[model samples]
Target: MTAGRTLFVTWYDSNHRSIIPVGRLVHHGGAEGDLFEFRYIQGALEAMERGFQPFIAFPDLCKVYRSSSLFPFFANRVMPTTRPDYLAYLEVLGLDPTEADSVDILARSGGRRETDRIEVVPAPVKDETGGYTTRFLLRGVRYIPGAEDRIARLRFGERLFWMLDAQNESNPSAVALRSADKCLLGYIPDYLVTDIAKLLEHHVSMNVFAEKVNLPPAPLHHRVLCRLEARWPDGFLPFQGEQFQPVGPLTAPPTHADHALQ
Candidate 1:
């Protein structure tokens, strides 16, 4: 991974353990109870405890503000690009999107009571090679539990987002946090996906897993095609793997992964 890519952090209130993002998954969700919030607080506290100052996203949002009480140790500044995606998932949870501001934090900081709210955070924006896509550090990283200090020192991140490619979706965990036993959790906004093309490729990978989600085809940049062609003895072709088996007689277009490490 190159330096200064964007990371998106989102939390879902479910009982599944954190899924590791490797191979094809673009995002990860499926945390349970107050786990998302608690882990976020842990992420923040861990940062401050390490003697580094912390920058905060979602400052206008209550859960983020309340998170401050947990660290009374570090100061936080608002990061303009940090957008959280909890509002969308809250509806799926069958709960009203509660604001951390609506409740009194003095009573809830350590209480860890159900606040009926979810938190979302996005990495600062960057390009495929981890170059800054936006001004400032708005897209540097998503939330990394227990990694504030380490991330602070590194430009890109040693952290990886662990989500199953939707193309490779799997059965939900055996545990039950929802009323019914559910399977196929799709969105948990973790990891820093800087390459839109790579993200599109990951979506393509997800095609093998879930058919319900809408992932569209991506137009490859000419440079990417040239790079792919340069790599092959005959010419560039789609990567063939167990899940991403190609169908057409024609060659496959280059994906984000093809040009990622370049």
Candidate 2:
């Protein structure tokens, strides 16, 4: 048995390689095991207008609530019981066998030129001394100052700047990072607020830095990847598992049946 984990719902536009965050799923320690919640974002609603309906009941904007026991959106990500089935799924996703994280599958799925779609996968949460690190593939690169030039100089495992924007009207828990020269970069995803915001409110020592910098002409949104490292007085427990099992196949179909927009 291990600590529970957090999963994020993201919609990928393969034509542009852009990712739109839709909802989240948090599976914590409880007798119920996996309590699922799904929320629809503004982007999801817009997608719906364009004839995209990923769920039988399209989630309301900015609202959060529990989902059904056998939600296919989550069930498809859980590792299949049989080795052949697991390998076959990976092959369909064009993923390496070792790359088992459902989030990775979701990310890769965006690169295809077919249709934009939604996926549920694990969020990146790493535990360190008295704190933990959360990573984001920085968005809005075009807004940063000479972002392309600066990113060219950044090496692997380099540190960048992180600052919180409490006044951000859209989301109060917004955390932003900048370049070494103090130019604005991008923000931490909205899904991280509940946990990361608590750490900030307690005056926990948090460090923000650059983990990886992918230069252009890569997709504008995913060019620079950043990380937030928070240090608390008490150590935090990170979620353990390469794959998340919320619901098994016995209770649901093999694929995300609800997300298949007609």
Candidate 3:
């Protein structure tokens, strides 16, 4: 795994189509294993007003706390210990099941509706050119007929807009993809939500467009392809496109066998 990966706490209000960044978790690598430091962000002021306190046991909001273990706020994302447990967790996120790591789960659930209002999302990982690309199958085609014809007419790289679909009955975090005329194209995949949501929340410049559109006789969800490229502005701090390092090596808590020995 890469190093320097940062995780953030974000609050998504589906009613207002808003994402508020509340806090950040940075991994300080060392031999103590999985150590992390937590701090709140300015965007979290609203949450603070609403009585949501920091996860660490601290009285000062400006103070930073480090733990050689996972904090309770983030431990929920890493608690599943079995396949069934993992699947159940994924179901809560409205994601299809597969073998996935904590990072994958975090990325997918960052945009999850059924989970808590605040979620943990990994910061965008940029490529060598200080940019990153995201590819996803378009969602919500069933709601719009004639989408096939409309998609067929779209040219590659045609600009698209990502907006929060506040009125979506199915998922609150449903991000709608729109054309220049504001026609609904589809949605960003569940997995891509965390990164894209954070980018939008922070007012980052992103170039989004239709990458590919499959012909009919195929599933509607898979018919339209979309992509988002980060156009990092000069001196954009969040655009830290660097290798991610793990906080520390993780060791499973003692199991029944270990208890028996003890």
Candidate 4:
């Protein structure tokens, strides 16, 4: 469904050592209640060519799967509400358990597990201002200057900003996040760089805020949660390229593959 609640299924390509968005999972809400569908995108084909085996649950490369309930594979990723630390976990993610559903939790927490390379990444939603807004954990925190101390000092809802690092030796298009006085925080995830750069090149009104900062002992990737808001430039579509499309029609490509991390 073409709703704002879309999330991309990203797979960390072990062979290539890079992240690839392999599918689209959309929540199509209606009077009938929750309806969800998942379809492999072009990235899935790319992953297969690069040696990524399909998951045990969804083995087909081109079949469209639908369910009235959240698929078990993803449902299992969220911590159960019955867990003793569930509430505190939500607090760490800056979510209200009363209002946050499974999808919401997955979006903020990234549905990450050490056993798997899969991750759930929320797609940017178009806001009322005709722009888009999304939230993500600040990446590369361990490499930032005084990162933990600066993150510890950040208050709730603190406004953060970014500057283009055209000189970055690793990635010329890297977007560096910083505070008001301009101390480096970290960069947005690499998967988002091109789209973010487009918004900047087109002069979109960009604003980033510190939604929550999980200081110390927390993993570096989860050190800070920031929200970015920007106008969607005309003719701009994120994640709609050929690489995001299926290589062929939905003909059901081997739906019974064994789960292999290799």
For TM-score, the strongest prediction is 4
Question: lDDT tens string, model 4, 42-81?
Answer: 8887788877787788788766777767888889999999
Q: How far is candidate 3 from the true structure (C-alpha RMSD, Å)?
A: 9.8
Q: Which ten residues in a row have the lowest lDDT in candidate 4?
A: 253-262
Q: Candidate 1's residue-wise lDDT over 71-179, tens digit each? A: 2211111111233743432222222445432111211111112442222322333247633221111111222232323322322212122343434223232111100
lDDT of 2 at 120: 51
Cα RMSD, each candidate: 22.9, 9.7, 9.8, 5.0
Candidate 3 segments exceeding 4 Å error: 1-3, 13-17, 30-32, 50-60, 79-81, 85-100, 111-115, 134-176, 179-227, 231-233, 239-262
Candidate 3 residue 3 Cα shift, in angstroms, is 5.2
Q: Pick the candidate with the highest lDDT.
A: 4
Steric overlap count per candidate:
22, 2, 8, 1
TM-score (C-alpha) between model 2 and the true structure: 0.53
Candidate 4 root-mean-square deviation in Å = 5.0
TM-score for every candidate vs. truth? 0.18, 0.53, 0.52, 0.85
**Total colliding residue pairs, candidate 3:** 8
Which scores better on TM-score, 2 or 3?
A: 2
Ranking by lDDT: 4, 3, 2, 1
Model 1, CA-based lDDT: 0.23
Off by over 4 Å in 4: 1-4, 14-17, 166-172, 250-262
